[model samples]
Target: MSPPRQPLPHRGRGAVSSPHARFEPLAREGFDDGWDIAEEAPPLATDVAMEAARSIISRNDSPDIGFDRSINPYRGCEHGCVYCFARPTHAYLGLSPGLDFETKLFAKPNAAELLTRELSAPGYVPQAIALGANTDPYQPIERRLRITREVLEVLSKSGHPVGIVTKGAMVTRDLDLLGPMGRAGTAKVAVSVTTLDPVLARRMEPRASAPRKRLEAIRALSEAGVPVLVLAAPLIPGINDHELEAILEAAHAAGAREAGYVVLRLPHELKEIVRDWLVEYYPGKAERVFAILREMRGGRDYDAAFGTRLTGTGPYATLTARRFETALRRLGMARRGGLRLRTDLFVPPVRGAPGQLSLF
Candidate 1:
């Protein structure tokens, strides 16, 4: 028989406990007798492993998402946003989706090479490739590794249309690449700014760029002639939902041409992680917040259905959608349909035979 688990102390991370995987029937626990239990030590420093990937682009057929093809330069994000839905993907690597998902990272060092090879292949069709679709490409480690930048270099040389979504200010470092692409209508960027309150953002996102810094990035991107979109993502109920309008307003003032928002989504291991975070930081309102989410999700923690997953069902969901639309219309930022990224400019790489001159 397995012993009962003790609550893990908050360690400046999102998840409170690394619960055993459901595939395993047994669970482990820590026990104490009388003596005070010292606070849990901070997680170990981040460890990055280079991954040689055979393919860099991933295709998805999800009905709700905007793009069909995307690239993730890294596996596992260090931003440590408690509401991040991608955390559970770490379990597939036999790693804890809690702290391990943040501290243990993987980089696709061969991503650019693989991308060039794939693009050079015959019968290849070009479409707008989404960057940072799963894990952030501009996370802190990017300052040193620059794998994302290398991938951008390949994409730029090929004249491939690309869209980027990130919360890292480090993205500004690549203005030299994005600027030309943006002018050519081949690039657009969306900066995720969850909240304007520094304290709340600090607690919720931990290591991501500050709310104001993200705003600055938006402004910078706009001034560079790159179309900027502000994403007020993962709007937690009874938490940051009240600031929805304010976030959009701020983004518009920062020169963003478009805006988007995603309601909080908890799936698989993420459910327990978010719950733990709520109890630790907002114990008094935890129950109320969850109740509201349940109401929106049809009396459940989450609903993964195609149309209803991004925005929940029921009255609260409807109201949130209406509020977002109304705000967008009022701010004169309502976008009809989705923004079309240019594909006509794509130029496949030329692969010449060894020691042969190109017939230009």
Candidate 2:
């Protein structure tokens, strides 16, 4: 039999436990024995492995999402947002969606090469390829791997439109490539700032850029001519929801021309993950937070219906939407990705030629 698993201590991580995968037939938990025999576990460190994916493009026909296709340069985000809807994807790899979702990361070293091949396919269609849709393309590992940068190089050479969504301030490092493309109307970026409270941000998203840094990233991207949109994503009620207008205002003052928001989503193991986190960090408000979320999510932890997935249904949801729209009007920010990136500029790379030839 497998050994019992104890709840992991918080070590600058969002998840305090590595729960059993839902697919596992048996579950294990550590309990305190009268002897107090268990020793404190050491802090968790991140582990990244290369994934040789057959394809880099992920196509989705969901009506709620804006893009038809997207690319994720990495998997299992290190930012470790407790409310991340993408965390459950770790289960597909036989890993726990708790700590495993953040500590066990994957880098797609060949992503650029694969993207080039796919974009050059005979029947390939040109459109804005979304980045950071599932996992953040600018996660900390990206600084060393440079996989996301390589992918951007390929897209820039072909004049392909690419839209990026991230909470990492490091995205500004690629402005040299994004600048010219933005000038050509072929690049855009969305910066999601969940709260202006640094303490809350640290506990909720342990490694993501601070709220101020994200706003600065928005300003930098906009100044470089890239269309910048601000996202008050996963806006937790009784937590950051009260700062909705303030977040939009800060983003607008930083030069963002668009804004959007998604209520907190607790899908799959996320429900348990977030519940535990709330009890640990905001014990006093945890019940009320869940109560408000349930009210917005049709009296459940989450609602996956197409139309209501991104924007929930009910009175609170309606009020949130109304407030968002009103804030946009006051700030003169569009309630979308702002400008359409130009797909007509795409220059397909010659399939069998040297990579350098594509730049011309």
Candidate 3:
């Protein structure tokens, strides 16, 4: 049976409210739509927070990724990328992975304070901390939230090195902070540009900054002396695959010093969301897209094995990698070898009242 489609709610233009739609778990009669173009109606969210004692880090053991520690100031991204792997995480909070992941958002208002405490801890280690590994640090709510900026202030004050991945041009607002970090070797930024086609980008990453704006962001970050990395992440075959070379060339010309790519990964609820998106927007190409993805993923929708998941297996995957590598080589850009971050610089905060002297 086809999944029922409901009208997704919009918080009006430029409101920046969480726009994810909820999936009604049980069968109901009124919600049938052939394409499953569900409109996720959700109330505008007010900030809810948790007091974090030490929020500076999270350790990861996934061999597929390079970084060991990461910091996310928010939960539930507003960008609403249908292919996002982080969507499943919302389920743990008793939220529907479908719309709740995007509509009902959470903010870590104390992230900056906790980060400062963590940085000052006695045994704290400082490898390059990753920002936006899960939820985008610079999502639209950030304009008012300012949590991400607060955390950056903590990192900058401590002289800690950090790496960031984001799709928002809002990062430009922090040029004052990032430029100094870049000069001091304390910061680097990578902007993910999935496709240059505005139409495709609009449908796929409904709320993300437009493609041209992202290239402009690359230019701005580069001009500010920040080492910029261009990421053509989660490349969807038969969807935006044809834009690969063009995107790389555009980003390189726009001053991206390094480049990388990840094939589309549809893990958990994302499979249904992305499938629904395709059927709605590209009805004729949906089957072919899924077919190519399956072929690349060893005949499954997705293979979660660390090594094979990020980059798929089989002939089609190999060709995609080859294409990316050739583009990188021609542009005089490296394949983004492991970036070793400084961990020895971490200093744990003194444990005592604000002004109390600690005798160690």
The best candidate by TM-score is 2
lDDT tens string, model 1, 1-360? 344344455555655666555445566656665454556656657889999898999999998888899999999988888888898889888777787788889999889888888988888999989999999999988899999999999899889989999999989999999999998899999999899999998888888999999999999999998988888888998899999999999999998878888889888888888887888789999899889888988888888989888889888889999999999999989552256879998998755544555466
Q: Provide the clashing-pair count of each candidate structure.
A: 0, 0, 13
TM-score of 3: 0.86
Ranking by TM-score: 2, 1, 3
Residue 139, model 2: lDDT of 85
- What is the RMSD, in Å, between candidate 2 and the native fold over all Cα? 2.9
Work out the TM-score per prediction: 0.93, 0.94, 0.86
> Where is model 1 more than 4 Å wrong at Cα?
1-12, 23-26, 36-40, 351-360
Candidate 2 per-residue C-alpha lDDT over 1-360 given as tens digits, one digit per residue, 9 for 90 to 100: 444444445566888667688887778776655544445668789999999988999999998888999999898999998899999999888899999999999888889889989999888889999988998888889899999999999999999999999999999999999999889988899999999999999998999999989988988998999888888898888888999999999999999888899988888999898888887777898899989889878889898989898878889999999999999888788988557889899988665567455443
lDDT by residue for model 3 (1-360), tens? 654554543442112222232343543245455756656655555334443434557889888787888999888878877778888787667665655666668888888777777777666667788999999998888998899999898788677889999999999999999998886677899999999988777766777899999999999999999888898887888888788899899999999978888888887767777776676567898899999989988889989988888889999888988999899889988676434445445445544566787687
Which stretches of candidate 2 lie above 4 Å from their native place? 1-8, 37-41, 352-360
Report how far residue 342 has shifted in candidate 2, in Å: 0.9
**Which residue pairs collide, candidate 2?**
none
Q: By summed lDDT, which 10 consecutive residues of candidate 3 come out lowest?
A: 12-21
